[model samples]
Target: MSEETKQPVMIFHVSSEKGLNEIKKGKLRGVHFFAETCTQYLSLNSSLLNQSDIKEAAKWICSPPVRDKSDSEALWYGIEGKVLDLVSSDHAPYSFDEKGKFFMGNNPSFKEIPNGMPGLHWRLPIILNKVLRKQCNLDLHDFIRITSTMPAKIYGLYPKKGEIRIGSDADITIWNKDKKVILTDEMVVDGSKYNPYSGFELFCWPDEVLLRGHTIVKNNKIMGKQNIGKFLPTKLSDYI
Candidate 1:
């Protein structure tokens, strides 16, 4: 395509070294490296689901279906080397009943299972744990860059939303680096009844979350009023 007609594409849930290389070669505009694509790919293989139990298979049923465990390390390297742009949750929530349909033989084919798993609540802690464990070479600044700064900048909220500076929104998360929590279904704040990260121990937890200078969560408990969120605008110029 000619430069005048070529539209920007944001690749989602990249799952392999080849895919990462394609993004680099094509000079793709945006790439979102999802949590499941990073960690679940290392721990779970799609083929194993065929021999595994229902619950196990259901947990592994997300899009760009988790790749071979070996591909994960290379993807991590892409992140550490700045080849990958950002990390996202792709937080799609389906109730146990919905995800269980495939297991119940509603449709035995793996392709019939819904694509996506909940991760918004778990994204922060998982990345932080990987950093703490030396599983990834990212430091706190890199974490902030990928999770907040870069995203805000890409979506046209920079200077006003992502940074710690004068005139910026007060949105922030206060993390307790020493705290640890074993993820459980009960901990999910969204409508989803199951969490893929259930039973994983995370070394850090958000003690508070602020939105526009208002305390939305304190002591890990939600304090925001319902239906209070406002939309922020974005523009094509936000692209890097």
Candidate 2:
């Protein structure tokens, strides 16, 4: 598969020094690291399992489980050094009950927990807020590049979707740095009844969002009709 594909193989939840070394090796051979691997490693430490309540610890349980608490700084340095390519949520949402399945048995184990958490809505805000608070070295331009431009280019959406040029699609997110949002279950538009980011207070949020020149979100509320998103087809050449 590697020889035939000739495309970057994306790795997930890389949090160890060994993993970082592997990512560096993979990049030379066309490999990329998913952003969540870096962000979650820095944000949620393995110590949380011991420090917080069971429910809180359960919320942080995802694949490639959060690494040793000591590795956070090194992982952040990896992102800063451009060892990581793009950011993604992996946006998988499982209900609270499904996540609790690990604890249902007499002997609870991390292995029984579901493998994902909801972050579709929180991805942008959390990263941007981090930048705002000076927690990371990223600037606004870097944020846009990692979150939008790079992903579009990677998937062949390029000039059509990533840019704000005259002929490009008007897909846009208007952020208000001054606006604050307290993330809670009620604000989640996804079907999940619980959000892993619930109670997070974000300093910046999207005030409006447009899709193909149509207003889809206004005042942070979804206004577009369901099933309005168009599918995009990408060619392997686009990846190159």
Candidate 3:
């Protein structure tokens, strides 16, 4: 973007104060910059990277390593204030048992390990955990906006993928907000035995998920088959 021509830009999985500050400057100039942060940045910190176990530390490795608690706090503030427009999983579900954090047969260098962590299974529940704890002044609407609505609109899926409007696809998630549980890797159906959030506590999680009115997941069990979905046309969204 320049003085004359402006375009919408989105920074995915942003987790640093420096990036936020730059976006702050752009916002003052009215630039159409959108930013997204993943749930790990909101909960995890760089302290894990400093541990003695390389294998343990590598589980937390991603493109931009998780920063200090201060940066995480700033990101939470960004989410609470709408400075960060969306939250994503950026889910890289590679088991450390393989090439995820290890080389042929030995523990790999941090640079050698594939970046990104596993959390597509817990993105919603983890953020909802923060909302339940009232840590970031997050509400249910904010959750829906960042995790669901905005991403759909930004990607041109709009009222079709995000909302429950009449005639819209019945893609929905039913949540049991009062449920309490401690996380474990066995619960992950993505076939990734290692999870960075293995010990996380959650107050809410999805009870069921419907795709195009088909109940795909219910009571933590997947009932839908693969390759049953269709492609959606790519169109520029007007709501953005």
Candidate 4:
């Protein structure tokens, strides 16, 4: 990762294409590579930098900062071409007070501030709502491959953990494509009150979520106990 410099301020734009090119040329070493590009980068662009008026928006702010429309195009192409493996939230929640103090002009330096934002809930929806909806030629399998199958395969969580088939755990999410609602703080705040998608309309949401063999979420509310979530053991040998 490279930092933005004020003097020249030129960003080293490394698209997935260039990275793969370097690897193919033997300039970089690694037998295989897996990369995760987040929701904020997928849906947002440089327009967000000018949205400093909205303090909460800055909460999700990241550096190697959001690029222009061109970069968005490159990222979309990367996703479509199967260069990017998984889409995750990189979920983090910070209070307005915590984020507000940095931009107060006291420090006046981008490096001094803490970097992160909240989006545990909205990550999946944004992908489905924005990227998938606009993809004209992408099939359903391609969609599932990027979001679910690839992640499981790369991390060795496949067939046994992520897929839906006989003998596999019945983990699944039934999304209601007809459901439409304008997002607001009143409705969703997993651990924080602000959402970047606040006031944005969503056409779909998960109507049901099954964890393993049990129904945990029904009609967007928890149907089972919260503490039942368990951690899985990691075996590095299986993958390496």
lDDT (CA) per prediction: 0.71, 0.72, 0.84, 0.61
lDDT of 4 by residue, 104-222 (tens): 55434455455666777887776776644664335567667767876676666767666898877678888887788687776664655667667778787788988887998898778
Model 4 CA deviation exceeding 4 Å by range? 1-31, 52-57, 98-109, 135-137, 237-240
What C-alpha lDDT, on a 0 to 100 scale, does residue 23 get in candidate 1? Answer: 63
Worst 10 contiguous positions by lDDT, candidate 2:
30-39
TM-score of each: 0.85, 0.83, 0.94, 0.77
For model 2, what is the C-alpha lDDT against the true structure? Answer: 0.72
Candidate order (lDDT): 3, 2, 1, 4
Error of 1 at 158 (Å): 1.2
Provide the lDDT at 142 for model 3. 91
Which wins on TM-score, candidate 2 or candidate 4? 2
Candidate 3 collision pairs: none
Q: Is candidate 1 or candidate 4 better by lDDT?
A: 1
Q: What tens-digit string does per-residue lDDT give for candidate 1 at 1-240?
A: 323456544566778878877766655444332221344553345674675465557766787777775677777777777766678877777766744435445435666667677878877788877887777788888788777887787667888877988899889888888898898989877777788878888888889899988999998688999998787777654455
The better-scoring model by TM-score among 1 and 2 is 1
Tell me the lDDT of model 2 at 135. 81
Error of 1 at 11 (Å): 1.6
Estimate, for each residue in 1-240, the C-alpha lDDT of model 2 and write its tens digit.
443666455566676766876676766675432333545666666775674456567777777777785676666666677676577776767666643434465345667766677778787888899888888787878788777887787667887877899988999988899987898888877666677767778899888999998999999777999998777776653555
TM-score, predicted candidate 1 vs. hidden true structure: 0.85
Question: Which consecutive 10 residues in model 4 have the weakest lDDT in total?
Answer: 2-11
